[model samples]
Target: MPKKKKITPKQETALRCLQQNFDKRAELAPSSDDVHATISKSSPVDIDVDADELEKNIATLSINNGNTRIRYILCLDIEATFDGDKSFSHETHEVIELPCILADIKEGKIIDEFHTFVKPSLHPQLTNECIALTGITQVDVDNAPTFREAIQLLDGFMKKHSDKLHPPPQIGSPPPNGWPNLGPRNYVWVTDGHADIERFLCLRSCRINRVRLPAYISGGYIDMKLLFKTHFKERGFRRLPDMLAKWGLSFEGREHSGLQDARQVARIMLFMVQMEAVQLKCNRSIVMEMNLSFAARQL
Candidate 1:
């Protein structure tokens, strides 16, 4: 049997371009409702035969430059309350039972989220006060998957999304079977504070043998607690909440709901990206306008 050769980087890029062209072709087809609606938005005289030609031109441009290299961020936050007695005791330490939320953010908006409750194997019992504050009890953790399961699920989700980022195959060519050419993608998990990471590391009984999650997730994390202190020193910014308010946005929602908090964090980061893109576009337009004005002055 002959060994199949691996796809070179140039060939991989070509495959992506071909797939994008296929998507463009499908969009311009007559039966496509999306194509029809986009055509209706323009004037009748400018429509007709030019639409297909325009689509082909756009396809060429798309193939030449695709946004597949865009970064994807995994935002996460955890909510936990101290379990056991009301008073701090030397004999017993407050057991922290928590739920963690994970979200996938790209181009500044959160596209997917996962919420999971971690079963505190070491601290199985919960105090009444803790239950009231966190709304979590022994019953909740009884059947819930352990922290290890949650990590496995998270890893699987990342792999799935990495696969999804591929541009569809080009038209008229048989669909690139199950495996479309794959590429290296980034994964950065952000947490509200370092406590969540700390807690996971402290769990002695929990399954820690399989994967070293922290090392893999160290790429980019927007730690609000760390950012607040660093911002003041470097950028003269006061606090995260203050910065968010200045940007005309406010963070709201239940504090301990991991999913809700992760979503809010994703939204804030996405807003920053959107504003920067808009600013860049405006600056370009202003430069063009200034050049045109100077030309008119010469006339």
Candidate 2:
């Protein structure tokens, strides 16, 4: 087995601050220059907590913070193909394969991730082009879990993992001053269409039969493609990658890879929330602030 590296205190501190900011962003708390400055200037505390313990602590802190409301936005992305013939039947534009990724976003940060490959039960074979493009083979699909099973596993994972951490309050909860916190938090789903979500919902409904997820998960999915088109027309940006570059943040790694793409989008969302808060000079605890180790990237 390979040696596991240890995390330093500096990295832990920075991660804590990141998580705090994410929570605050979820609640639309005003940006705090004081928090930013404090994080920037503070030296890392030399503590000896294990990385796993540190992460649990941070999650606890995020759940307990009452200063800013927080929410967990679960996002999924799917893979599909475009037929050369648009005038053909609807089935002609069918999806050859699919992969799903789930990201738990609090405030503006992605705090957790889940991913899985799905075999289309109805479509066992892939076109040669599809196989070449996605690198998914007919054997791969045949051996993979069915769409319904895949989503059920994902749902179970989401509930299990998310429940392990304390969840932030529902968005729009009354502030300490008793005022209704306002603003839409955009649960941006980067996908080809609503198929993934539809499948997820259908699977979830089948499992619970009647119990429904909260409205946050139930309604208003932000489609990146639509957002891109609108941005181009109104702001002259053509794509997500273009938008991120313009904002001075780069989406690293391959574009179409499911988990990588979800992680990239999650980061972009967090950055946007911070920028928005900073621009407005809002001082709310949009992020849970803490410090841990430099070595544990997960922490």
Candidate 3:
């Protein structure tokens, strides 16, 4: 057997953070401004620790000066198909499947999942290759909702969960929800990779006749694959199964199916959270880094 690589001190610290659940993760994030108070409640120091030292400790690992608020993460995935053409351009292909699961970052579980098959507008007929490749039957396409209808369903699903996360003064008719509230909301949308989003926008753009994609669609989503790549110092884009396997996780469910793929993305993410991989959100998605070697060089 090959020798295992030795874990470093930073990695050990990261591991400790995971063992403690996400409390440490929360300490470093922007939302927990009163981190010292919170941690004091969880694990009290026996000796009289100086207030300055406690503040110093919190400041060292903290992501910011403590301002922004992070709440939830929306893990999602998409599936698309192409006519038998080998050189199919994503520019031409449409979204045939879309699925998403809203995961509670603190609670550590999926609150809800949404998926819908989208009937193609241009091609309309699935090539034999498409059928075999995705295991999506022609009947699935024929009876499924249109791409526009899928968007409506997605909007509805987001509204449902958004209200659950932050309940309204009163629930009536879904009331156009608070997604547009430009302040740093505690929730973010995540995907296995970026191409899925690109394809989704491609199809949606065509339907909207070049109108701007919704802000929720454009800036709202994070490509989780990028997060993993940054964490492990990985180069180049990879398929979901390959990324999962690299992290010693087997695929959770059906590979190509959108919902299953989304679920797998969610599970792997939870695994990362468990491993104490730190996520810092400055503006876009949280950038998780493993700087074990870099920190060692500093010492």
Candidate 4:
């Protein structure tokens, strides 16, 4: 019998994804209706289209290199308090935990970190399921800042970092399946999945507080789930644990801790950069014009 040739890990995963026909949309649980609706706002865009010679005065679209290198990256993860244990209700869900990291893209390591627990105004007492699933305790929320205060703290961090970092490039479109290079700093939001972005894009946080949406998230965010899809063309996204396992990685911190999740995301990003697979950037962002009631909010 002939011995089979060895295949690379990326190639192997591709084979598995192709064989399994993973459903990218299926990553969300049925109770994820809020996330589903929030994510639905951004539609997939066509970078280029075939045109007929007969069509007149059509602008030519150039092909992009699909290279989306950036100088810096900001990773964010938010864990909210929900009414139900399993399902997060959009009407009642509030941002109870937010963890973020600022990292040097070239260095592939975190430079600073910010994390805080937020007190939910509407649903002050976290449901039993939320505590068990997220490993947050009543004391955690009891001593935490209000949602507004937490946002202020995050804004302070970003402001300090902005002064220290380089300016961003001119706002421009990214390659298909890539994030918009908003500035020279190459700042883009990163998350393990779409659910996090949904929470912001939906503007639920702003509406609950009756304030304008924060400018921090206005820059746009990268969904690792979509980024992975771009590379592997997989049907569905893998759970964070499964994704880590594939790369021989173990969860470094607690499962539901926002800080841990943010750190893990940074590590994953660093791995991608080190392996030369970090081309993907964010492709969608919150259409805040529709959500912010034309009121401008500072970062």
Top-scoring candidate (TM-score): 4
The clash count for each model shown is: 1, 19, 2, 13
Q: Which tens-of-lDDT digit does each residue in 67-129 have in candidate 2?
A: 544344444555543233434333423333333333434434555455555555334566666
TM values, all candidates: 0.49, 0.49, 0.64, 0.68
Q: Given candidate 3, what's the lDDT at residue 56?
A: 19
Please list the Cα RMSD from the true structure of every candidate, rounded to 1 decimal place. 23.1, 18.2, 16.0, 13.4
**Candidates' lDDT values, in order?**
0.38, 0.38, 0.51, 0.55
Task: Give the higher-TM-score candidate: 1 or 3.
Answer: 3
lDDT (0-100) at residue 213 of candidate 2?
A: 25
The order by descending TM-score is: 4, 3, 1, 2
Error of 2 at 137 (Å): 3.7
For candidate 3, write residues 1-299 as lDDT tens digits.
12223566775564444335433332332221221122212121111221111111222222232464445666767667676677766555677877766666566656566667777777678888888877788888787766655555655555556565432111111123322233334555667765565545443323433222223433334567777777777787667777666544456557777777877776667656645454634223221111100010000
* Candidate 2, residue 91: how far the Cα is off, in Å: 1.9
Residue-level lDDT tens digits of model 1 in 1-299: 11223555664454344334433432432321221122221111111111112111222212112333435545566544454556533223222333222223333334454555555545557667667766666676665555454444444444446554333211111122312222323333445555444343322322232222321332223454454334334444333344455344454555455555565555544443443231100000000010111000000
Better candidate number, 2 or 3, judged by lDDT:
3
Give stretches of model 2 more than 4 Å off: 1-68, 81-108, 162-217, 225-237, 278-299
